[model samples]
Target: MTNVFEAQWEASQVEAMEALRAWAVAFAELNQQMSSWLDLPTTDANALGQVLWADSSGDPLSPARLGQRIGMTSGSVTVLVDRLEAAGLLARSREHSDRRRVTLRPTPAARERARAFLEESSAEIAAAVQGSSAAELATSTAFIRKMAAAASGATTRLRAARS
Candidate 1:
């Protein structure tokens, strides 16, 4: 009893979901490759990536903030930070107004390694999307952000339900 418009909308939704799933798979593969190239486990690489992103955004992460972002315990974060620091991939400094707070930053070597590994792929991705109209690209960006928000909200709800 569905109308033609409803059917078409449903088809579009299905296609969007499939594309999102494919994107997730591709992202995981990229993470795996990066991890291997860095000679670090996936979790460590992910934490490093978070630190790099936060630093690049001009808000470097404290250990506690990094733990919250990565869903790790404070003790676990300490261990991870120690490991990364020992490997010379990360550095911790008390640069905040409150000297007690330690900020995490990726070392130059880590940044160079990541840039070397990702520059080509990043450029290719930009090239692939360059043909899209500005409006189309904006719409796609908004759609991805909406999808991410929905997924994150669902995760929060599920965690709350468990608690």
Candidate 2:
């Protein structure tokens, strides 16, 4: 049911996706190394990144939400939060009228440190894409987003099956 051109195109697409996956793995390892440089565990670094992302999106994270994002248990997240708080990386604040609700916010020091640590890599990445047109960038962004959504969906399905 497939022509040669179609088959070749599909094969090339698969190869491209595999290359992207490899890049993702390398990026994750780089993140782990960065976390080590900051004396934080990989999970802690992931949590902090998630918190920062949420804040940048104008929706701060609560401990429960942070745990959900990171696939951590509430108890584990609480301990992790405590450690980060002790290290002056984050703060837990009662921002809501509901006194029981607590928000996790990255400290200014943490933001500055993360920015400093990432500046070099960020510059390199930006430079790598410096010649891309807006349409190309948009297409790449959409493709990556689609891949992320597909991966997330697969994870959810796997978790449901396990449960």
Candidate 3:
């Protein structure tokens, strides 16, 4: 026999899980649309997004680092960079400290386009979240962070297990 408090907590957990799932689905769909709008292939768009997020200062990312962040192999990252460079969306340069190391950076045009696309997407997502109360938004945000951390940890454990 479950106590009333326990039953309510279980119900809240269920609701939170359902809401998280729905948000994930919706975000994926929205990302697809935004990629289409930007005329970027999903892989390229994702790579671009990673670059935008991980970029510190104006320097490009090392291919190895980018690959690690995006879960791609070095070979695949090379291919991805090749395609992006060919499209004039990004360029590669040798690091000053190490001529042997190549780094990938977005072109000026790509940066402008990415910024506009992100602004539009941010507006859309903001509008959606605006429908929620402040408390609900805070709860959802914390729940999302918790879930993301758990997923990331699980992925790491799975990789270690496979190895």
Candidate 4:
């Protein structure tokens, strides 16, 4: 018979793997919706989405930082941002304090359109989750947080190593 600790460890591993799989599935579904909503090529949609979801401080994200979050390289980020800017979805700006630092921000139109799309998507997701039991919802919420934290930590380490 397995010891209690061993059983608990195995259960934890299973839970972690399951959570990862669920996150991948949810992300894929969301990606499909975003692709259709933005009417953009996959890469462009993803890059634009990252800009749209960024904080509202009106500060631009560095190309390197954007690339790290979007799973692309600095060069690719530059090209992607250029395309987005050309399409009027995003704009490039240099900080007044440090003109050497370039950053990207989405245009007002892009932000409005993305917000509508996300609101509809969120409503649909909420409706579906509402059917779940409270306990199930709680478990799912906890699982998502745990998995997101794990992914965020991994991405941080990867970016640090690259820098």
* Top model number, lDDT: 1
lDDT by residue for model 1 (50-93), tens = 99999999999999999988889899999999999999999999
Please write out the lDDT profile of model 2 over residues 1-163, one tens digit for every residue: 4664455467768887898989889889888877886778899988888888798788999999999888999999999999999999999999899999999999998888788777855776777689788898999899889988988998999999999
Instruction: Give me the candidate number with maximum TM-score.
Output: 1
Off by over 4 Å in 1: 1-9
For model 1 the TM-score comes to 0.87
Q: Report the Cα lDDT for candidate 1.
A: 0.90
Q: Give TM-scores for every candidate, taking all chains together and pairing residue i with residue i.
A: 0.87, 0.85, 0.75, 0.71
Candidate 3's residue-wise lDDT over 1-163, tens digit each?
Answer: 5665455467768887788889879877876876797688877777877776655366458889888777999999889888888888887878678799877777887788888887877886777788889998998688788998998998999999999
CA-lDDT, candidates in order:
0.90, 0.87, 0.80, 0.81
lDDT against true structure, model 2: 0.87
Error of 4 at 108 (Å): 1.2
Q: Candidate 4: how large is its RMSD?
A: 5.1
Candidate 2 clashes between residue pairs 3 or more apart in a chain or in different chains = none
As for candidate 3, its clashing pairs are none
Instruction: Identify the superior model by TM-score, candidate 3 or candidate 4.
Output: 3
